[model samples]
Target: MFVPCHQKLVSAFLLLYCLHLSAFDFLWPCPQKCICRQDTLEVNCSSKHLTVVPEGLHISARRLNLSGNRLKTLIRRQFYGLTQLEELDLSGNIISMIEVEAFQGLKYLRILKIKNNRLKIIPVGVFSGLSSLLSLDISKNEILVFLDYTFQEMVNLRELNAGENDLVFISQRAFVGLQSLQELNVDHSNLTSIPTDAFSQLQSLSKLRLRRLNINVLPNYAFRRLHQLRTLQILQWPSLETLNSNSLVNLNITSLVISNCNLSAIPYASLRHLTHLIYLDLSYNPITSIESNKLGELLRLQEFHLVGGKLLRIEPGAFRCLAHFKLLNVSSNRLTTLEESAFHAVGNLQILRLDRNPLTCDCRLLWVMRRRFRLNFDGRQPTCSAHERGRRREFRDFSEAEFSKVFICRQAGILERKLQDVMVDEGTNVQFECKVDGYPQPSITWLSPQQTPFSSVGRIRVHANGTLEVRYAQVQDTGTYLCIASNAAGNDNISASLHVRSSSRNYTPPNFFDESLVETSLPPSTNSSAQLSSPFPFDAKTIVIATTMGFLSFLSSVVICFVFMFLWSQSKGQIKHTATIDFVPRSSMGGGGEGGDTGRFTMKLI
Candidate 1:
């Protein structure tokens, strides 16, 4: 049994040695100055004080780490045997010139990282033989620009990272045959401008990170045929104070981040045409204001984050058309107030973030604070600095429970409001009183059903007696209308509905008691077949009814006729139109623009 076990152990040793030889071909009789370790599948011939790589590298080796070496140039005969190599690391080397056909036989090479090299210009067709290259990291090199076809035939290349290089001008069609490219990072390069039609054929490019390039202007149609681009980060251009509107006309992107630059204002009108954007980040800019209804055209936008921009004030209704949003972050600004109806389209909002901003504790902030739910904040120093008695103090120190403590100082009381549940027909005048409890007389403003605020006018008037009156109310005004009553102390708001009563659209004169009768009824003794001939009869039983109906009709006719005659007579006469003008004295109107207290009045009608 011992002899048989010895034989089995010998057989196992032989099988393992053959497997090791197949993995590292440079073993036993290793290459001149290279030491191939079969156990680790690693060749550490790097920085061996050699000027050139000896021949006969492992054909089955998967990786060769040649960093920290003194190889100034590459010849084809050195790497002519590495057929199964997938990863080649030549980092921290002095590779100055890469001869043509240097990598001719490495068809299955996937990764090539040549950081901290000394190549000034890469020749064409240098990497054309790497058909299976996936990722290439050539950072920290002195490459200024490469030939147009330096990386021509890399069909399966996915990511190319050439950041931290000295690239000033790139040749058009530099990255032509890289069809499988996904990510390209060339940030902090010295590129000034991208030539038009530079990226005309990269149909599969996904992410292009060219942030912090010395790019002053991106020429029109610079990114023309990049239809499948998903993410674009163009930021940190301090000299870029403005963008010509035609720079990015039609880009099919999902996330567009432009921040940390010196842009005074984003031309929202230019971006109103991008119909496929979903996430937009325009923070860290110097934009001061956005016009109302800006960003109203981005129909599919869901996440809008604009923070760290030195914005003084956003005009009310600035984010007019950005509805159906999921997350909106507008914090870290210099804003003092948020009007009560700040979040206009808050019906579908889920997350509203407002942190690290100088929010004045006033009635204006009460509107947004009353609705902020699950608001995320900085927990370490999460305190809202507010002005209090004689000085500024920290209030609401980032606690969920404390945020519920509304800090209203000397505001109005809970002014009671109620609505009458009475039904009225259409075209009838309706009136209601707006009552409130305050030290100052309450001034009221009404808003129509369609979210339009009302003004005191001829048709819809508000009397000094605090009564809201509307004449000839139409069916379109059949919805809940808001009434906001406010004075110096605070404000109180409520809504009232005016419903028009029309015969229900479904109301059919059901089969009358006599279905065969052509007319409704007649003032007779159970007569079903006889039609109401003249709608009235001067009979004994119907005399009183006929006389009453005649009186009402005559009265209505007299009122209509009187109104028409009065209007006609007034039209025919020399009607003198009165104009009320109380001109302010020159001395009294010295400083004020409108109010001079000289019984000031002016009238003009359209």
Candidate 2:
């Protein structure tokens, strides 16, 4: 304690020097070309073009990024000093070989990324001691196979991304100890089929993506053991054709997407088991139709999407009983008409996307026109087909009154007058013409005198233009024939009598314009009283006059009924009647359907 003053000063200087060396130890020996942030404890040696792992790394470095380097192989104890490192990225390297225990002392490493490398095989014990690793990304590599117990030591790994690899085979126990893994991605692999045995080990997997695999069929119970899986996406599988009905048998997923595949129809049977499914996307497949009762079992389904396919028609009741269904997108298909009954069973549909389709503007779309303002079209309103009067016009551009007028659905009516009686000799050919018109082009049906329907077979034939042709008229064909034209609106009919005489009798064809010759041309055996008692005594002019009067009467009756309904609707205050044609603005309505107005307009009769 009684030292000299000069000696005390020298001792104090030595002590200060030792403290400075210990405090700046991690900063002085930093790698030559690497940037070391002492405050954050991060060392970045990326893109340095070094052929080996750099020396002089700090012992307490928490994150080390050595990506985009030229390191060829990872020898044992390559990172033996960085015991506290939490994240290590060795991506974009040429590391093809790794010795056992290469990562021996990284006890607290949580994330390891070694992607985009040229590693062809991973020997056992490559990841032996990384028990605390939470994520491992080995994608974009040339790994050919996954041997058994490859990742058996990473017990706490929760995510594994092995996509974009040349993987063709996976051992049954490749992922034996990864019980806590929740997400796995193996997309763009060369696997020939679903590795069911390998996948069955991941009992805790919640999301899986298997895209662009060289596989054809998804066998039954492929994912039966993935009970905790909630989302499954199988995309860009060009060779995938058949999805067995029991493929998703025991799954409880909420979202399933199978896009860009070779599916020719909806896999209804395969999807029937996912009763809790909420969203389904089957876009860009060759599906042609949505059959009835196939999707009715998915009562909890909310969104159904089938865009960009060869969908020509959706059968009636296709979306039946889906009470919670909200959105349906079938845009860019070959659909001509969407029937009103298709959405009759849906309880609360809000959006319907039918754009880029060849939609015919007709009565089948009347229901859509009425609810154009109420329903959301996803900002891409549907346009009419080129054949309609309002070609390429958006549904939102037309007012309700204008739409009703342009897209009229009239009852079927025969254009020609009553057919004249025909007196032909036996073995002669006869024909009767029936021209009709309607909005939907009613179907033509021919009925023989015996009340039996005549088809385009045997001696009787019905032509495409609504013509009834008799090849060889016989005596049995000497009765009244009827032609009926019918559609959803209504039906119309016309009748004509045919008199076929025996070939032996001398007969002269009567002129239709000369009434006297028509009356006298009857066969002698046929009684005059019976001929005069014919109910069709009207001439051509008279028949024309009667048809015109009947049409006028029908028009008046329709007007009267419409006026009565309009008055009644106004009295009940359920619908808003307008004296002039005007668009129903969306802002005027309350909650789409809560107000008295149902977003429809009525034209008051003058």
Candidate 3:
């Protein structure tokens, strides 16, 4: 406890020096439960459970955050002395009323966020002195209508977000003075139609989002005045059904998204004028097919997405002349097959997303299989449906050597063993069966000896079962008929000869008359060479060979049937029954399937 006088004096001097330096640091007062950074002139008073704005804020504060608080009202000249304030955040508050002159002195403020508030109506002069504001967010509010000249004072405003509000009516002059506005968002509103008159004033707007509106149709020239718009998104309009032919006539947009709508088909006519479009997304629509030549006008389109739709087929030449196309995502669709011709014009495709589709593994998809490694699947590889082997498998599971085996295709083959030549009397009904089979199910067409194509019309008709029926056989119908079956794999043809004899002549059937019987039935004067030609021209040796082959085929069929029955009976006898009980978790029970059963007794034979 005893100290020398020299040591005590030195300690006292050091203590006073430290106190002097701390005095200058405490010149600016920071309110309780608030953080004030003097170096950056920023103050954060967020989520402090404060009832009123803190007093004695730093004069040089350039940024202030009062979000997530209980502040209900902003009085006149609330922040009068904070002249250097550039950014102010008052979001996530219970602010329902703001005086007209509350922000009258914030001339330097550039960004103001008052979103997620209970503001019912924004009076005309509420934002009177925020002339230098560049961005304003009033989203997630209960604001009803935007009266005329409501935002006229924000002349230099560049971006405005008024989404997720109860906005129903907007005056024509609501956006009269926002000349420098570049982006606007009015999503999730109750408006029934596009506010064309109000949008015409935003000539400088480049990006616009109008999602989740109650509109049902997009009328012609809906966005004609938005000449400078480069990106437009109209998503989640469930009632939207029709897009008029001239809806997008004057738009020069490069990116467009119209997803999650009730669009039954692509609005090809409406998109015909968007020649400058580069990215297009029509995802989550009920579009069943993409017809040929409909989207060819979009030559500059590079990325296209039609995900989660009812798309069944992409016809040949559907994407013709899209040389600049790169990315295509048609995932989560009901597509059975995608032919090579569908992407013949899209040679430059780099990223393909064909996953989540029931694609049939066939020759039509051979082109995709060959380039599987070179193309980017975007993390979701394509999967083949159960059409081939009753199980789904990803395309990457197959190797180059399995290409021909997995993606198999057969050329059309006639089911009949041989084409039957027929001789029918005139006026009798004549029919020719040309049943054929092939991968992708070939289409049948008939051609007469005169080179005339026959269809399901007039006296000659091609039935749905691939049978060509001629109601009344005439002399013109006599001759060889060609039945052609064609598909993507290949084409096959079979010919049948038909002879129609006149009804005036009486003749014995060739098959019924034996060689000896024909000679006796004919007159003695008629020469043997002149007798009707025998329909059956088989010799004794030929008859024996045919009979032996028929017997062998029948015997082989019987043996195979017996073997199948023996195996089935043996397997059935070996099965043993075991009583098992399974208890499914509540999480699994929510699925409402057999596997999700709460409690089940599985009786398996052991």
Candidate 4:
């Protein structure tokens, strides 16, 4: 074993020479102008107008980027010593066709992104021995159809982006062994809705962007096993027109952004039952009106942005139960009025933006506007009529500055709205007058408790706002009455009451009474005994005058007693009524308004 060092070297040299001769004998001749790089042992003579694979490589380079070169065909057994090759990206070359088993010995390849290349179809078994492959991206190519198991031996493949390819139909079990696949992005491509359970085996998967596709109706339980997913963003889908409450049947997703749909409406119960939702985006839709009771059920909602939807009206008790809400944006709409008491329960309003709408302003908002204005430096005072005479208009104009002025300034120069007057009487004509302000005169309409607009009755007449008169009121108008004066900012309403008072006996005689009939029963003896004769002496003509005076006094006494008795009865009836209510509820519309006293809301809601 201990031979001379020179002898051992000579023997090793001969052995290496024989092996080199044997390898060179079978290998093809190296192409001209091709340089075998010493470090990687790869022949990189591409893009020099060569027609065949460069042979006689150094056989060490395992990876190659021979893209951006011209080579038409991959000859059989064209790469014999490239067994150590792991990954390849032959995308930009002019290579058009390849025979099967083109990569028979590239066993260690892991990832490939051969998208955006010009190939008509991928040959079968093109990647058969690539057992260690983990990912592949063959999207954005002109390949029309795929042979079964185009990725048959890529057992370890976990991700694929085969989107944007021309392959229409993928044979079933085409990617069966890809059990380790976790993420796939086949979006923005040709396939429509997925057949039922097409992704059932991808339990380890989490996210997929299947929106903006060709399908109109989403098949039921389409996402049956995707429970691990947390977010699904269905954005700008052109053909998607409808979505039932059960569309998200199998999803426990935390967030959903279903914006820009073709929905006519949304049920309040539909949104309220998604109890686990913390954020939801429903903007740019065609929902016309929201159910008054719908928004109240979503107590956990934090933000609601309806940027470009067309909302016409909100019901009286619409948002009565949105307790912890923070932001509500109802911009770019056609709303003209707001009720003063609608926000009575919304005490925690921090930012309420109602900009760029035609709002009518008037004094009827003295209460609500004044209170809202006092909230902060930025208060919104609904615009009101400025000039008292000559075609009184609502708010002259609406601007951000005007809205800010209403906020900073506690009161507008003119009370844009009038106080509402509640009447409790039959046929009690209530006139709700308000001085609205705007470019043109604001139109005034009576808004009933039922939220219906009523034109003025002959009994009720509205002047600019100097005064409102309720004539011959009965007990029927006992309910609340609001004088809604509107222009652009919003409508202002004032509430007052018409009380039907029970009739009382007032037998007040004429102011000028004669001083003649004065015959006192106890003072007659005292006045005659001393310096005066009989105060009402009973002599002949004197006796006649005295008797007449006495008779008159007796008659006057009886009349006073009767008047007192009648008054006592009226007072009793009044006491009984006061015990019930200021305005009688049983009173019908405009029933018992027999004019007594009118009350005003001096202090605003603030």
Top-TM-score structure, candidate number: 3
| Candidate 3 lDDT score at position 18 | 86
Give lDDT tens digits, candidate 1, residues 339-364: 53434476666665566766555445
lDDT of 3 by residue, 1-606 (tens): 999999999999999988965763576578888888877888999999877889988778999999999999998889988999999999999999988878988999999999999999998888989999999999999999999999998999999999999999888999999999999999899999888889988999999999899999999888768899999999999999999999888999999999999999999999999999999999999999999878888999999999999999898988888889899899999998888787645469899999988888888888888888898999998998845652488888888787777788888888885856999987778889999999878889999898788878878889988888877677678999899998888999899889988774653333434566444643347455644565667656789999999999999999999999989988877654587777765763455555654767778764
RMSD of each: 28.1, 33.7, 26.7, 31.3
Alpha-carbon deviation at 576 in model 1, angstroms: 99
Error of 2 at 14 (Å): 24
TM-score against native, each model: 0.60, 0.68, 0.72, 0.47
Clashes of each: 0, 0, 4, 73
Q: For model 2, how does the per-residue alpha-carbon lDDT over 113-150 read when each residue is reduced to its tens digit?
A: 99999988999999978999999999999999999999
Quote model 2's TM-score.
0.68
**Better by TM-score, candidate 4 or 2:** 2
| Angstrom error at residue 586, model 1 | 99
TM-score of 4: 0.47
Instruction: Please tell me which model should have the higher lDDT, number 1 or number 4.
Output: 1
